[model samples]
Target: MPWTLPSRPSRRSLLAGAAGAAGAALLTGCSGGPGTADPDPAVSLERRMRASSVRDSERLLERYDATAAAHPALAERLAPLRAAVAAHTSALSSSGASDGSAAPSAPAAAPAPGAGPAVSGEPVPPKPEEALAALADAERSLAESRTVALAGAPGELARLLASVAACGAVHAYLLTPTPGAAS
Candidate 1:
C-alpha cells in the first residue's frame, strides 16, 4: 500500500474550527470572576457569607467582653475563647479568592470604642454560672449558623468557615463546667 499525503484542510472547515474554538474560549472566560459585568453567582454569595461571618465573630467578641465585664470572676476563663473568636474575625476579614474567582466583600465594620455587645433588651446574667451558660448558648448558635452556611460557600471560604464553626462549637463546650467533676 502506498503512503498517501494528507489533503490540505478546506477553508470552510478551518473557519468552522476557529469559530468553535473562539466560542469556547469566550464562554470559559465569562465565568463569574469578581468585578465582571456578569458576576459568578457563587462569588457574590460567598462575599456576603464571608462578611456576615466576620460580623458574627465581631459580635461574639462583644458578647465575650460584656460577659467578662459583668462577671469579673469569669474573665480569665473567657479570655482564650474571646481571643479565638477575634482570630476568626481576622481570618474571615482577610480571606480573598485564590482561584482567580473572587474579591471578598468589604470587611465588617469595627465596633465603637465604648460600645458594648448589642443588647436584646436583656442584660448579661447576674450570676457567673448563668452568664457562662449564656455565652455558651451564643457560641453554639453561631456555630450552627456557620455550619448551615457552609453549603453556600466557595471551596476556600467553606473550609475556613468549617474550621471556625468547629472552633465555636468547642468554645461552647469549654464555657460550661462539668457537673460531676470536683471544683
Candidate 2:
C-alpha cells in the first residue's frame, strides 16, 4: 500500500490551534507583558521640533530672498546667510521631516514689543560695516532660537539643531569685521 499522508488540518483544527497560541500569549502578557504601552514623550517632542525647524528655515529663506530683493544692500550682505538657511531647509526636507504649518509671510523680524531684546535706538547702519554688525546681531538671535528649540528636541532633531547653531555661528563670524578690512 502507498504511504498515506495525514490529512491537512481542518479549518476548525487550525482555529483551535490559533486560539491556544493566543491564550498562551495573553497569559504571558498578563504576567509581565513588555512593560507599559506608553508612547515615548521624547519622540513626540523631537518630531515637533524637527518639523518646526524645517518650517522656520523654509520661511526664513523665503523672507531673506524677498527682503534681499526689496533691500538690495541688505540682501547683498545677507546672501550668504540666506543661502545657508536654504541649505538647512533642504537638509530638513531631505531628512524626511518638515512641519506642515505654513509660516507667516513675515516672521517676527524685530523682537516683539517688550518681549525680550529691545531693538537698539542707535541709528541704523549707513555702510556695509554697520549692516554686517546688524547681521551679526540677527544671527545671534537666530542662534538663541535654535538653542531654545533644541533644548526640548530629541534624536535626530537634537543633532540637526546643533548643526544649525554651528552654521549660524559661522554666519555671524562671516559678518564680523576681519583684520585689515575697512569698516
Candidate 3:
C-alpha cells in the first residue's frame, strides 16, 4: 500500500471538535465554584478599609475638640481645620454606603477635661503651644497611616484617603507655629 497521508478533518468534524472543546472549557472554568471564597473578598476588604478610615477620622476629630476646649486660646485657629476633618468624616461615611455597608456614625464631642489625645491615648499638653504641637503630631501620624493604607485600598477609596492625608499634612503644617514669626 502507498504511504498516503490521511485526509484533513471534514468541516462537520471540525465544528463538532471545536464545540466539544468549548464545552469542556466551560465545565472546568468554574471548578469548585460556588462559595469557594468569601464571595467577594475585594468588597469585604474595601468595607473594612472604609470603616477604619471613618473611625480614624472620628478619633482625630475628638483630639481636635479636646485640644480646642482644653486651650480655648487655640480654638479659633483649630476651628477651620476641625471643620475640614468633620467634612472628611461625612464624605468617608457617605462613600461607604455605596458598598452596601452602613457608614459609621460621626464622632462625639471631646471627652472629659484633661483627657489628652483621644486617638493615641496620649495626654494633651497643658500649654497651648504644646497642645497645638501634639495635635499636629497626631495629624502627621494619622496621615502617615492613611498613606500606608493606600497600598490595599480600592481606586476611589484610595483617592479619597490620599486627599484626606494631604489635607492632614496641611493641617499639621498650619498647626505648627513658625519660628521667629508673629503669632
Highest TM-score scorer: 3
TM-score, per-candidate, Cα-based: 0.67, 0.52, 0.70
Candidate 1, residue 72: the lDDT equals: 71
lDDT of candidate model 2 versus the reference: 0.55
Flag clash pairs in model 3: 116-124
Report the candidate with higher TM-score, 1 versus 2.
1
Better of 2 and 3 by lDDT: 3
Model 1, TM vs. native: 0.67
lDDT of 3 at 152: 65
lDDT of 1 by residue, 1-183 (tens): 997643633445544543443344344434536665554676787778878888788778778877776677777888888878887887787647456454433323333333444343346777778888899899989977876676656666766776777677767767767655574
User: lDDT at 14 for candidate 1?
Assistant: 41
Model 1 residue 13 lDDT score? 57
- Candidates in order have lDDT scores of 0.69, 0.55, 0.73
Question: What are the per-residue Cα lDDT tens digits for candidate 2 across 119-145?
Answer: 333333445455567656666667668
